[model samples]
Target: MRTVIRRTAVAVTAASLALLVTACGSDKPDAKKEAPAGDKGAQSSAPAAKALSTAELEKLLVEQADVPDYTVKADAKAKPVAAAGSAKADKAACQPFADAIGGTIATPAGQAVRMAVLTPKDSGKKQSPEEKALAGLNALKSPATRVLLGSYEGDGASEALNTVKNSGAECMSGFTVTQDGETTKITAATPMTLAAGEEATSWSFTMDMGGGDEAKFNLGLMRQGNTLASFYTFSLGGSVEELPIKVIDAQEKKLA
Candidate 1:
């Protein structure tokens, strides 16, 4: 993923360099100011092209393959949470976090899916609150190496679905959760990468869930202004809810 990002960066740099060269060449009025007699016939058609209607221009833009469009997730939800407080309260406060499940849902696609998230404790007994939270999560029995957070890009609905498909979990089971008088079945799991402000990459995994319903979930966490917020989208038409979140910890014993 880092390699993908590096390549993109290099491409942008190259494009900018080309643009700079073009600008520098334009500064020299003596350089090829007049077109050749054979090219004059082609220049006559330029004004007609510029006279195209707005709709025509839009159609042309759509037909262009190289034109990039920022994929927008339709009815996408973006929830934000803070990163302060005790671990238990923080964990229990957010159902999504507690459930540790999220992903896109399509018709005939919604089903029973269970997910879990885990991280290493490192080598600290009285670890930081964040560390304790991660350790407690690690203690839970699940796929040992599949822990992560993820970010989805492009069309909102598909992006969410892709987030789940890429989560590296077997089939996603739609967990039934009640919210606002309606029982909403949603994908539960942790995120691959925690995106604070800037865009991040999506996470993927490949593992088998032995009869026991256990899978580490990735949580999208970031500090919003002064408070922390977690990202979430319930459905394609759902609005993003920025919920206040925190990380708390209880006194934990040292691991041998």
Candidate 2:
């Protein structure tokens, strides 16, 4: 009877160990199954907020002292208009082109658009060599450097950038901008290299000045949070290299 009782106790101990081992083995598969669910949860997490107010955008503009010899001021009465013959002529094709050049983006309803313009200090006064070169290249709308700052709410900045990236090729082809009774034909907008910003897109386009001579212009679009900045620089003959990069860095630092 004593031997039988001891054998029964040993058998019970063996059974308990086997059950523990089976449970441990089962837990490994359960953990492996739960890991992917945890990963999926992490993958579906919401993105960070990237909205900027108008005042914040206004503060992000490059200061006059930062870009010495340049006049940086807010355009109180500036209203962005589409390039002539755009929406009126081909609404579908022209819309994207208009947004790209005008720095216009699709924003949530009730959001206002803010803008500022930058140019050389003596843009309205005497014509400096640099000013003359820029004017000859059609880089200045009013004898200024013509950097535009636009701030949008919601996903407007991303939308504007997508328009350029997705439909730029189709919209830019045969695009024309008519100003002051003169029409300049843009043959192509080729992508250029960018050196700064969180995300940036640049292009060098050939403009038919309606003469035998053609002018080249550089357009840069940079996104910092919800703000989009545009830089336009062209020279009669000299290269306007790295100017956009400087402006982008300055603006990005301020935004940061």
Q: What is the C-alpha lDDT of each candidate?
A: 0.23, 0.45
Q: Cα miss at 72, model 1 (Å)?
A: 10
lDDT of 1 by residue, 82-195 (tens): 111211112222332222222212221111111111112232355677865554443332111111122222232233333333443432332333322333323443234322
What lDDT score is found at residue 102 in candidate 2? 39
Q: Highest TM-score, which number?
A: 2
User: TM per model?
Assistant: 0.20, 0.57
lDDT score for residue 130 of model 2: 71
Superposed Cα deviation of residue 244, candidate 2 (Å): 2.2
After TM-score superposition, what is the CA distance of residue 141 in candidate 1 from its true location, in Å? 37
RMSD of each: 24.8, 29.7
Q: Across residues 1-256, which tens digit of lDDT does each residue of candidate 2 receive?
A: 1121111111122222122211111111001111222111111123535565655555656776555323344444554333322322133554554445533445522222222123323334456777555543332331123455566555566566656655566655656644334444666666666643446666666666545656565666666655666665544333333334545566667756
- In terms of lDDT, the poorest run of 10 residues in model 1 is 247-256
Worst window of 10 by summed lDDT in candidate 2: 24-33
